[model samples]
Target: MALFDDLFIRLTSRKVGRDRFGNTYWEARSRKDAYGRPLRRVTYAGVPEASAVPPEWWGWLHHTTDRPLPEDAPRRPWQKEHRPNMTGTREAWRPPGHDAAGGRRQPSPGDYEAWTPGR
Candidate 1:
């Protein structure tokens, strides 16, 4: 066992719950800090990767939802599951008129205006 694990087991209270990614949470039962003042603490175990948490879990962790997402959250026949943003990737945004295969067509004549220095 790791030194931290050994120390954590000896010092903290009981294990609360674990997420699907193997991250565990431990909540202090006795409300007391090192100085004996009433305090609550939550300890996280495993690699602390924020992205590992799903959107529903994120909402619950931030107290946005009182209940953890249902084990079998409803999915409509037409609804699609959530996907991470990919705006900056190679497969990202391509406007309808932009070139994807080869040279793009020039802008139409009505799309331009003659600029005057004074105006």
Candidate 2:
């Protein structure tokens, strides 16, 4: 599937921009999506996950903006660098009680007693 997309992009799309993660963005020269917007796509540098695209380019890719944020655009002081989804990776977050976090759940207070079978 990627092979076909690559061929199509090479033949018909123009390079829009690339994100910090090295993902390349492209738009079709003449093709458009069902919504009549220009066909946009991203060729991920690694995994083909949607999260790989940063918020900066997301708007442009979805046609929400005419162009992606400029390369030199100033980031807000509180803005952090974009990171791809890590749900299944080793660096993924695990809550304290999760098995991967050693399965040591906190104990609850002994407030309620179990009901007796015939009580």
Candidate 3:
């Protein structure tokens, strides 16, 4: 199935560009969306997570910009590189009291009371 899909894309789309993460973007050779824009597509380089795409490519993929930002685009000193969403991965953040981190949490400051049914 994957083989056929790859062949279909190869036959029907043209490579637009690749992101820093190695994901390749494509545009259908003969297809257009409702807006009359060439239909855009992406072939994931690895895990197929959408968040893995960088901002420039994201803008192009969504039709927000005519083209993906150039590789030489200006960057600010504080700019950070893109990182994929890690919500379920081992690298995902875990709060101090999260079971994955440890079953212990910091003590409360005692400024509040537990809710009671009659209160």
lDDT, candidates in the order shown: 0.54, 0.85, 0.87
- Candidate 2 contains a number of clashing pairs equal to 0
The true-versus-predicted C-alpha distance at residue 23 of model 3, in Å, is 1.7
Compared with the true structure, model 2 gives a TM-score of 0.78
Q: Is candidate 1 or candidate 3 better by lDDT?
A: 3
RMSD of each: 6.9, 2.9, 2.4
Pairs with steric clashes in candidate 3? none
Clashing residue pairs in candidate 2 (N, C-alpha, C atoms within 3 angstroms): none
lDDT of 3 by residue, 1-119 (tens): 27787788889999998877788999999999998999998888887788888888889999999989986799889988887788999999998999999879998999978899977
- Candidate 2: worst 10 consecutive residues by lDDT? 1-10
Query: Whose TM-score is higher: candidate 1's or candidate 2's?
Result: 2
Model 2 regions lying over 4 Å from their true place? 109-119
TM-score of model 3 vs. true structure: 0.80
For model 1, residues 1-119, the per-residue Cα lDDT tens digits are: 46785476547655545555555544455756576643322233444445555554565555566445653577779865544455666776677566662546657789688899999
lDDT value, residue 116 of candidate 2: 93
As a whole number from 0 to 100, the lDDT of residue 66 in candidate 3 is 90
TM-score to true structure, per model: 0.43, 0.78, 0.80
- Candidates arranged by TM-score, highest first: 3, 2, 1
